[model samples]
Target: MRTKAKRAGIACAISILIAGAAIGAPRDVPTGDGMYANIKTTRGEITVRLEFQKTPMTVCNFVGLAEGTLAAAGGKPFYDGLAFHRVIADFMIQGGDPAGNGSGGPGYKFPDEFDPGLRHDGPGVLSMANAGPGTNGSQFFITHKATPWLDDKHTVFGRVVQGQEVVDAVKQGDKIEKITIVREGAAAKAFKADQASFDAYLKDSGGAAAAKAKARKDADLATIAAKYPQALKTASGMRYLILKKGTGAKPVAGKTVSVNYKGMFLSGETFDASDLHGGPIDFQAGAGRIIPGWEEAVLDMQVGEKRLVVLPPELAYGERGAGGVIPPNAFLVFEMELVKIK
Candidate 1:
């Protein structure tokens, strides 16, 4: 819990935050509040808006990062001159690494506040991009289209208030021209509407909540794996592990399962990642685009499940290796979570 002074410092950075850990609920709802916006790097100009009422802390933290107030609070800026890093064909543009290299962070990590109510149904929504749940810090992304896969897992704090065109023009390696943080709480009318929807989800399927949570955990793992493949690891003395069960719905092939995951190497070196963007990552089952190891495990996942996947070099980057982050012919480990399937 945040102390009274820490809560106040959230707005002013004058108070100390001793242990503002993740206030776990379900695999839904974003942690933090207030609203914020990003000036962003675009071909021309674009401004994104954040809905603070729904995620006050997330928004407030964003604002603090933008205003250089985080530095005052013993934290460094995570967004300073960061790249839009990764850009999918028509999805979103990602950035916000203090290291400027993909391996950097905000000098601190924070827990996730998942409400399972907010969704990634469409474009303009801004969600916290992290290595995993409770690992969110200062990274964020802006969606270019309606990516329902992002619903209920990532911390979504704002939306593109206007200037989505700017997002349309962003390309890989594009520099963030500038990001202007703004405060615009959720519309009074929309607040009630969103809240009602949240309540409805809670009331309608009380029994399925556990199932949904498992699905979300699985989805989250998938998200982390896609982006940080190097993070995958195998048990000592074991060459690899197979997914081995459950394939009723082919998550890789359709909207059945959308996940957020992190990947690592045996040495714990991070190789790749996907959460830096938004949802665990939306893809079809058996899509040949990813590494073979992923192809084998994901097809077996159900919604809301989190699992660890370890692969031998034969199934991973092979001999050439992924180059930079991953070494030549190495074992890998992945912590995957399937957040949703719809």
Candidate 2:
């Protein structure tokens, strides 16, 4: 359990909340052409118009939780007493954990719904928070400033339709007294019905049970090692096997390198890949821009070299794993190909 620093682009930005007294009464907002969620906090009310047309899955999931239609173990409202667990004044304000802690969720997870149309243009943008890709849960955040870095990384389900002042004034530990869904728009009702059906089906088929079981899977390092018997092991527990030897010089500190890589869990579940979006990502070789394992491993590789690297959690995300995708003490596998060094 080493002390882990927060990653710059990681979405596990929400922190656990410390319980506090309420600041205001719960209230509702008048709905308009679309689905609206009036989030009543201790300070004031902030109304957001959900974008079901663009991100239907995300909007429906949120509405169901708010209406108490999506119950957990005992069937209770999810956001009634939860506080804005984490709040970074210029970044975003996060909440929606019933336990007031960032660790709590709706007892299940769902896939991410990404839409290029929606973006973090300015303040009042509402988006789902996750540990990584396809791990959307109940936690959400409202931005106070434009965050282009978070555009496609998180699901933008809704935007502040009214009450920017309240959103700006909110702080951590301020209670979310209630979240009321006003489906005045036709789109809202449609999404609400769809989500209800989805939740009911999940309850009937025990989808959450299956998903939880999958998440608790054992590490796949043994399987990978047996598959790649020729891999070399390092003193730091990092393992690697060269795929393609380079023709140019090896990269050093302060030199930038561009590479294509695919990162996966020991379970063979791919967590990220540069190919998924488009091209390779460039970063300084030993500038601490990536995980310690990557910085150290890539330093020895030359341009055009490709290697399969295996890393222990200690050298990766460690105790505080990246949100939900990388669990505690998890092992990882990466196929990295260096394209250029400058």
TM-score of each: 0.43, 0.54
After superposition, the stretches of candidate 1 with alpha carbons farther than 4 Å from their true spots are 1-42, 72-80, 184-342
Clashes of 2: 2
Q: On residues 1-342, what C-alpha lDDT tens digit does candidate 2 reach at each position? A: 123444532334432121111223344565357788888888878889888778766776787777766655235567888899999978999998766768888878876666888998999999999877567889999999999888767899889977777888898999888787777755556555345575654464356545643564332565766777898999998889999998888888999999899999766779999999798999987888799889878898888899999887778887556755676556789999989987
What would you estimate as the lDDT of candidate 1? 0.59
Clashes of each: 84, 2
The positional error of residue 214 in candidate 2, measured at the CA in angstroms, is 22
Residues 1-342, candidate 1, lDDT per residue (tens digit)?
A: 469767776856422222221111111222234343546453544555565555655655676666555553244443556787878767887777655556666666654455555777677777888764456666778888888765645787767655566677678887765565544334522332232343343344444545765575466457545655554354332233333333445464644456667788655767667666765786665757777776666766666556677766666776445634565445677777666666
RMSD, candidate 2, Å: 16.7
Which parts of model 2 have CA positions greater than 4 angstroms off?
1-31, 193-196, 199-342
